[model samples]
Target: METNRNSNIIKLKQNLKYRNILIDAFPLLGLIIIILFFTIITSGNLLTLNNLKIILNQMFLYLIGGLGSVYLYAQGGIDVSMASNIGFSAILGVRIMYQHVGIGIIATLLIGSSIGLLMGIIYAYAGIPVFIQGLAMDFLLKGTLYPLSGFKASIPVPDRLLKFDNKYFAWIFLLIIFIFIFFTYNFSRFGKECRSIGAGEIASIQSGIKVKKNKVLAFFISGLTCGIVAVYTLIRTGSASQSTGLGFNFNVMLSLVLGGCVLGGGNGVKVRNAVIGAVTFVVLQNGLVLCGASARAQDIVKGILFVLMIVFTSKMYERKV
Candidate 1:
């Protein structure tokens, strides 16, 4: 009886190991299937060089913003205002460019970081929930920018900035940011602290993780990335409008989820997830267009996929827990 019981336990462990492997592979599999399906439907137009370039261009901002958001999300924090903050930062940057291009870029980054730091402090020290704080900040920034831009439907970006739109520059910048984030997130104490906090705040605090300080730092890092991405947006569009960054936060959240980064945080977070998710997202959007799908149809498809992905990932995490 003892021997039989031991064998059954071993069989159960083997089954669990296989289950975990499948969960890990699902995102990549989904990406592959999407690409293949779209390629066939589009008559292979999806993989043409021009379309590929367009996809890459669309992906740059999402990839960077998504990376920044990873820090906040890893600690189970949400910032609904990130898109608005980017819009405000771009407006400020464009205004400064009227004086000096170099100064404009520097000023934009500084403003973004400062605002992010302030929000972090409020959430961490003032006992405000990050979600509520983010919502307030979003409204405040969007309102401030709306009036300052003369309520213009679109703020024009300077023509001089258009020279910087080369894909090579974007690739290099993205690579650097990815490498820096990858090392910091995987190798540093900061990353470990973030994971611990996300896993269990009470447990992390009892373990001497300095929860408040880390939370503030995570927001700061997220803000800094936002600052950089603001620059990317300015160059890409050469302008900022009232609707400039509208819906960006949702897109980033969707990308993170599609990449397998759990909203509950801990253990499953990875920089690669941001990269893969960004690519998949851009491809999905572009492919839908190439396949002649209507705007409403595209949105409906994306929405359904987003919810299903969330449900699937949530189950995977629950099983692991």
Candidate 2:
């Protein structure tokens, strides 16, 4: 009887080991499947050099946004105001660029970080939920856009700023930001603290973690990235409008989830998730257009995929817990 019981326990352990391996490999596997499906549907047009370049270029904003949001997501928080903040920042920054390019850049970044810090302050002190604060902030920012744009439909960025709108600059900037986030998210005390909070806020507090400070800092990081992405978006498009950055926050969430981030957040949250997710998202979007999928159809597909990912990740999280 004792021998039989031991064997059963051993078998269960082996099964769990295999399950964990499968979970870890799911994101890469999903990415492969997406690529293959799209390629087939587009009759290989999705893999063309020009199409690939467009996808890569479009991916930068999502990648940066994902990287920044990873910090907030790590603590089971999110900033839905990111899109609005980017638009608002771009408007102010573009106006300033007309006067002084360097100062304009500085001002844009400050605006982004300041908004994030303000959210953190409200969350930390006033005890407002992150989602609630983010929505409130989003509306506030959007409402001010018209006034900022002088009631115009769009505002062009200064011509001098267009020089930064190339593949080379994007690649270089992405690499720098990726390295910074990689180090801080994977190796630093702050990363550990954030994950711990996500894992269990009560436990984190008891363990001497400064939960509030870390939470605020994470929001600041997110906001700062919004500023950087704002500038990139402005330079690439050469203009800012009320429609700028619309649905971006949702896309970031989708990318992160697609990359294998559990909405609950915890030790399982990997930095590479953002990179993988960003690539997957861009490819998916580009491929749909190449396949002649209608805009409405694309939205339906995306909505379905997003829901499926959320459900799957949530189940996986429950199993781990």
Candidate 3:
């Protein structure tokens, strides 16, 4: 009886491991399926070189933001203020640019890092929930943004820097960022520490992980990324508006989720996940438009897909008894 019980337990563990492997592959599988489906439905227009360029352009910022966010999500923290942070950072960068041509870029990055560091301090040391801190920050920035811009519909980019808008520049910049993040995330101590924290904070603390420091670092990285993307957004649109970073928080979250990165973190985080998800998301949106899906219909489809993916991911990563 004892031997039989042990054998059955081993088999159960194997089955669970196999199931997890399949779940892990789902995002990539889904990406392929979605692309093929859209390609067929759009009658091959989706695969054209020009359309592919459009998809790459659309996904560039999302991929950058998503990469930065992997650190936060790995530690099981969420920041709803990132979108507002990006918007406010861009505004500050623009103001500085107006005073001195090149200094504005550095100023914007610094402001973003500062805000992220502040939030991380509050969340890690002050005992505030990261989410609440994010909400408060968002509101504060949005309130100040209106008065600072004098309620302008948008702030136009400096004509001299307009050349940055070219896709070639964008791709090179994105590639550099991606390479840096990929190395840091896969090989650095920071990645391991974050995964440990996400797996369980109490356990991480007991293991001498310096949870507070790592948490702050994660937030700072996230902020830095937001700031960089703010520059990208400003260049891409050649302007910054009240709506400049609107919906970014949602879009990044969605991209991460779609890429199979769990909200609770720890188990299945990868830099490639963000890239895959970002590309998949852009393709999905562009395909829908080509197929003439109305805005309402698109939202419905997206909502349903989001729910299904969440359910699938959650189940895949659940702890077994």
lDDT of 1 by residue, 14-104 (tens): 9999888888878888889899999999999999999988898899888998888777888899788888888888888788988888898
Spell out the clash pairs found in candidate 1: 157-238
Task: Give each prediction's root-mean-square deviation over alpha carbons.
Answer: 1.8, 1.8, 2.3
Clashes of each: 1, 0, 0
Alpha carbon lDDT at 140, candidate 2:
98
- Given candidate 3, what's the lDDT at residue 148? 68
Model 3: per-residue Cα lDDT over 28-119, one tens digit each: 89899989999999999999999998898899888998999998998998889999999899988888878875798888898888899988
Candidate 2: regions farther than 4 A off: 1-14
Predicted model with the maximum lDDT: 2
Estimated TM-score per prediction?
0.94, 0.94, 0.93
Higher-ranked by lDDT: 2 or 3: 2
> What is the lDDT, from 0 to 100, of the residue 38 in candidate 2?
92
* Candidate 3, poorest ten consecutive residues by summed lDDT: 312-321
TM-score between candidate 1 and the true structure: 0.94
